[model samples]
Target: MISVEEALRIILEESKALEGEEKNILSCLNKVLAEDIYSRDNLPPFDKSAMDGYAIKSEDTDLYKDGVSIELEIVDLIKAGESSDKELKNGQAMKIMTGAPVPEGANAVIQIEKVEVREDTLHISEKVKNGCNVIKLGEEIKVGDIALRKGTLIRPTEIGVLASLGYSKIKVPRNPVVSILTTGDELVEINETPKFGQIRNSNEYSLKALIQNLGLEALSFGIVEDKKDTLKSKVKEALEKSDIVITSGGASVGDFDFVEQVLNEINADIKFQSVAIKPGKPISFAVIDKKLFFSLPGNPLSAITTFEEFVKPACEKMLGKNMESDNTFPVILAEDFKEKEGRSKYIYVKIKAENGKLYAYKAGSQSSNQLITMSKANGIIIMPEGIGYKKAGEVLSGKFIFK
Candidate 1:
């Protein structure tokens, strides 16, 4: 068995980012950019009005003081998405709406609320500074400047920027296709009623949903029986069709465990057969033909924990993205916890905020098969290896898992 850190390092070191493909910007949400994107034109394209006001020369309002009012002739009216060719003369003002282009010779804008308009003339009561309420050309983004660096994850704001840059399509790293296979003779389809000794196949469906939530394509191969030949055939098919293959169950050294045997038969390079973590200790990792493989434990909590800790980071690495931190922070234990030492333990916890302080208590039973306990947990309290007992009020590092 190896430490969790070592296992992750091995997985990332062996994985490489997928190739890039040109995709429509609309379809590139969550995708990583393959090249640095530069602004083709200045943001705003031209000097623009930042508010609905009158564009006038700063000199016009320079001499105005308290109880003094200045009036100027209205030369033109400009609304957003429109431009005016008329230039502002001395003692002249243009009625400009927000986002409208600033007319030539206009150095500042006085908001309509600060002025009293009567017919074709405007009465300004407030002194305006030069260049106030004006957005200069290229103020936000300059032409030929790097608007977004390579490896940036496309979000809604990024989409807006790409549209402004006239980019209909962008080059981004391809999302890896993940194939899921659940192996066990005791597992039955979700739609069917299990016999006295069988259970519904929830692992495959849960794993599939988790994969999709991570923005990766998931291909479900359904449940493969415990038979070695059947598992081997299904595993072979998944390997050919996916960049990452994940099989839940048949990872431990049980009589029905056939996943390890199949991997060995295919001459796969098994990186680690176990990790020094409770509930997910039997997890296995391997690589075959440059494709990643993960054999998660049969238990639901164990499977989910291993996937979040190991597979999630591997996927991020394959997409040329920095791994997101778990956002772990210290929390006061609400109750005492006692366990034998040997492996790192992750206990499901429900967190409560009291007087601006966070307190963590066990959700319920810590059994790996207790799905309800996992559901009630918003975070996980981590107890490092060799530490056994934790009394109430003790500070421990906890990570929000439901985020």
Candidate 2:
């Protein structure tokens, strides 16, 4: 067994980002940029009016001081998407609508509401400063400037930016296809009644939902029997069809556990067979033919725990997302808990906020098979290795779940 950090490092070091593909900008939302995006044309393209206003030289209104009004001749009216050829001289103004290009030699625009116009003469009581109410050419983004760097996440705001930059199609990393397979002879489908000493398979459902939460679809190969040859064939097929394969069950050491044997037989590079983490120690990670394979424990809580805390990061990295930052925060324990000293313990609990401090309370029994314990939890408190038994009022690092 290895430390959780070492196991994670091995997984990430073995994972590789997918190749880039040309996707339509609209469909590229939530995707990672493959190249630096430089502006092909200046935003706005020219000096335009920020609002409905009159464009005039700033010095033209210098004489209007002490609540005095100044009058200027109106040269022409420029509406949106229109331009004025008239040169704005001192004592002359052009009525420009929002988004209308300002005429040459104009340095200021006074809002229409702040000025009165009568008989083609514009009157302004307040002195308009230079560059007032005017959006200069390339104010948002200049030509040749990088608008977005490579590896940036594309959001709705990025969609608008790309559209403005005339990027109808963009290059983004290809999303990896994930496959799910559940194993065990004692497991039955949710719709079927389990025989004596059998239970319904819930790990497949949990894994599928987890994959969907990451905006990726998973193909389920249904349930495979515990036989070594059958499990081996299904694992091979999953590897052939998908970039990532996740199998929940037949991972732990037991009379019927055959995940390791099958992996060795297939010549797969098994990175780690176990990690020093409670409820998920039997999880295994392997790389075969440039594809990732994860054998998660059969227990429902253990399977979910391993997937969320370990497999999710590998998937995210392949999709060109950063996952280096730790989400743990100091949380006070509201109840006492005890465990063995060999592995790091992750206890699911209800976190409550009182007086701006977070406190972790027991949700239920922390059993590997008890999915109810995980269901009732909003967060998890992590107890580090070496030390055991934490009493109420003790503090541990914790983070919200499924956040």
Candidate 3:
């Protein structure tokens, strides 16, 4: 049995950076950037008006001091999307609407409501500062400036930014194709009635949903019998088509656990097995022909926890996403915690802020098969080996799974 850290190191050593591909900007949302995206041109591109008002010179009116209103001739009326061909002269102003290009020689803008227009001449009623209500050229973003850095994931706001910058395509990492498999003779479909001691298989559904939530493609290979031949055939089929393969159940140390035997039968290059963790000690993982395989525990909670701690990160790395832990916040124990020594343990707990301090309360039960306990829990409190029990108010590091 390898330590969790050593197993992780071995797993990470097998991973390589995913390749990049050009994708349509619309399809690039939520995709990781492969290269830095630089602005093709200055934002706004030209000096434009920011308000639906007239453009005038800053010194056109003596309104800066006692607010002297000046009468100026409105030579042109420029609305949004229109440009003024005529340049403003001393004591002259252009009636420019919002988003319209500011006329040359105009240093300020006075709102139309602030002026009383009589035929061609306009009377300003308030002081106008230089460059007021105007969006200068390259004000928001300059040309050649990097709008987004490499490895950055594009979101809706990023799409908007790229659209505003006139980008129709973006370079993003190639999303890996993943296949999920489950092996058990005592498992049946949810819609079918279990015979004798068989139970409905929940691993496939939960694992599929978890994979999809990570923004990747996941395919189910259906359930295979726990027999070595059936398991081996299923593994080969999934490995032939996918970059990563995940299997749940048949990973424990029982005599019927054929996952390890199946891998060895196919001459799979075993990477690591049996991580030093509670509720998930029987996890198995291997790398065969550059493809990844993960054999999760049969217990639902154990499967989910192992997926979050290991499989999720592996998938993210394969997708070129910079994944980080969200549950690094300091949390105090709500009550005393006890456990056996040796293996590291992860206990589900409900975390909330109480009296301006964060506290964690243990969930109902610690049974590996209890999915309801995990559903009611908010986070996992990590208890490393040799540190068995913790008293109330003891500070410990934890992670929020649903956050």
Local accuracy of candidate 2 as per-residue lDDT tens digits, 317-357: 88887777888999999888887887998989999999999
How well does each candidate superpose onto the true structure, as a TM-score?
0.93, 0.93, 0.89
| Candidate 3 structure quality by residue, lDDT tens digits, 315-367 | 77876777554537788999998988788888899989899988999888898
| Model 2 lowest lDDT segment of ten | 59-68
Better candidate number, 1 or 3, judged by lDDT: 1
When 2 and 3 are scored with lDDT, the better candidate is: 2
Better of 2 and 3 by TM-score: 2
Taken over the whole model, the C-alpha lDDT of each candidate is 0.90, 0.91, 0.85
Tens digit per residue, CA lDDT, model 1, 298-397: 9999999899888888888888886655568999999998877889998899988999999998899888888899999999888888898999999999
TM-score of 1: 0.93
Q: Can you tell me which runs of candidate 1 are displaced by over 4 Å?
A: 324-326
Q: List the residue pairs that clash in candidate 2.
A: none
List residue ranges in candidate 2 displaced over 4 A. 116-120, 334-338, 353-357, 391-394
